[model samples]
Target: MKSIKTKHRIIKAVSALTALVLASGMLAGCGGSSDKDSEGRTIISVGSWPPEESDALTAMNERKARFEEANPDVVIEPDEWAFDRQTFYAKAAGGQLPTVYLSGFTEMPEIINSGYSSDITEALKNNGLEGMFNENIMDIISRDGKIYAFPTMSYVLGLAYNVDAFEAAGLMKEDGTPMQPANWDEMVDFAVKIKEATGKPGIVLPTADRSGGWIFSAIAWSFGVEFMEKGEDGKWQAKFDSPEAAQALQFIKDLKWKYDLLPASTIINAEDWYRSFAVGDGAMTVVAGDYPRRVAKYGMTPDQSGIMAIPAGPAKHVTLLGGEVMCIKNDATPDQIDASVRWLKTRYNNELTDEYKTNTETTTENAKKDGQLVGIQSLSPWSDKAESLVWYRDYIEQNANCNLNHVKLYNDFVADCPAEIKPEEPVC
Candidate 1:
């Protein structure tokens, strides 16, 4: 029996909206190039790749085109850089910076420290898109209580299963959807039943060290890690060594030892882990914000594969919040910031622009057919539709899941990575 207990606590979106409005006035005008012309184009550079074939790179190029179409006078240039967490700052330095660009939410500190990006308060105000992002995440990017970035994805970490694997394991739902196990015990039972039925490992256990760390953090959090809380001294305290964290770590240790259902080589790298998934080593695996689309391309369509959140635990049902956020350059001139806002609002809220937006990037815009969980708390769009870019407003109206809270606690996890691995090359 999956005995994990989960209680959901969602932060109110109203508070976020309230904060955003108040925040816009704080950084009313950014300082940047004063040039202004209806015919003038602000060169917005982005990290992109080409000539060398890469799926992710292709996706970026497709979106770049759509942005140009929507803002006829803006030139969105490719700010090519390695996708590693390190190189982004280097690119941000060379003055090769775009008026605006995408970046990781947690990494905002680096940007703030460097003073490369514009403070987005005014742009967010002009478009009325402020504070709509996950509140906690907004807190993460904020310094001295001012907003700097716009959170875009509301992703929930969940299981993505192989339909063929399920059929082979006799685990399909009566509705013919692939079985998506909900909590931990159910997950283990399903894994065992499948392996017994098919002689293959039941869960691949995403062995890549850092990736596994991501899953492990969610598990520990679901198991109840009292992360980031005001300490007795009233400072943010790190709690990775807590009992709950240890238990979570032990659970992972058990999966590797007692479960005996995962292949060692599989844990070596993320690509290898996905390959095991593609070959149907199990009925299910932990899929991140981007992997469901990869699963769809594996053999069956996304609908056929079926998806659901991570297993519940005794403490809380939480998924490690991951993905990117778009922030403003703190140094950008007021005019440049406004121009960027015009483009951002069109892309962020414009209803008619999504399909064109998704199509250009080749991200799967239609992953929400079974619908999505767009928690105002979690903020970033749950877009596994790597090739789809339908307007987010339409998505939010139809499939938004209301319970997501961008739990500030889960942000401290550092992948306990092994030394043998190397990061894959960036697409752009």
Candidate 2:
């Protein structure tokens, strides 16, 4: 019989909002030229612009046109440069970045300390967006009481499992729900069953590009391991050299050697891990709540996959929080910052206006029409009380395309444990 547990668990509080950070290369001028365009509009370069062949480009251009129509003095120049750890530094150092661009939420420290991101507190205030964001998310991008970036989306990690694999392994219940692991030990047994039935790797983890370490931390956390802690001398000390951490590491080792649940290649990157899981090379992988959209393009159907809270460890049931943010360039002129703030508000469809409402409706409708996954649950960047969130929530419910049964466990855990959600280690 497939063993099922009633208790749902989630990660410690690591609050973040997930948005595409739009950063310009260091070489690109916030306004490529100080002089106005022939039409006398102030030009602002932005990143996360879809490629010419992308399906999202049309929607992006439409939003840009509307923003320009509403604010005639500003012109939005889209840059195709994307955010990556390696190229980000190259762009920042070379001065080719845009006026405002995309970046991960965790990169705030490096971006701000390196002087790549501008202080947008006053700009946010001016735009009436000062107190609109979730405070916990805002905290991640703020330093010394100053806000540096805008939180756009939020996410928490969950274990994504292949429904087909579960059924094939006889791990599915009569009600059509897969029998999920309640703890890490059960996860191993479940993987063994999956491997025996499917003749495929039962679980996958990224082992390259520091993704291995990233995935390791969550596992270690669940084992009651603290990567760091303040000592009596008031200095933060590395604490991972503990029994709990060793157990976590040993668990991973056994997954490969003893249980033989890992893939043929151990050197997987994050992208590879996701794609592998999507294509059914592995029965399960850890992913964020919004990761369904990412795997969708890989031909993973909604009914074929489901997400549940990460299996609990001996010490606790916890996961990692991650997301993205948008920031202004440090060198952007004040006028440029103001323009960027207005543009950001418009781009995110967060402003409280009839025009914004129409834009939101249109965007959601378009996603639905395109058969894009419409309703994977995500944390709101705005506060719970924000009117924008209310409508946005309603719209998601009304247009959701994915199977809610697939995501109910993770979503339910999130709804039930607001206080338990915690931030990840800053250095990771």
Could you estimate the TM-score for every candidate? Answer: 0.65, 0.78
Write model 1 residue lDDT over 273-370, tens digit each, in one string: 66677667656777664564455445544333444455677666556555566665555667667666776665554334446554423322354442
Q: Name the 10 consecutive residues with the lowest summed lDDT in model 1.
A: 1-10
Clashes of 2: 31
Highest-scoring model, TM-score: 2
Using lDDT, give the best candidate's number: 2
Give Cα-based local distance difference scores for all models: 0.53, 0.77
Candidate 2: Cα lDDT at 299: 81
As a TM-score, model 2 comes out at 0.78
Model 2: runs farther than 4 Å from truth?
Answer: 1-41, 51-55, 84-96, 168-174, 178-180, 195-200, 226-242, 352-374, 418-425
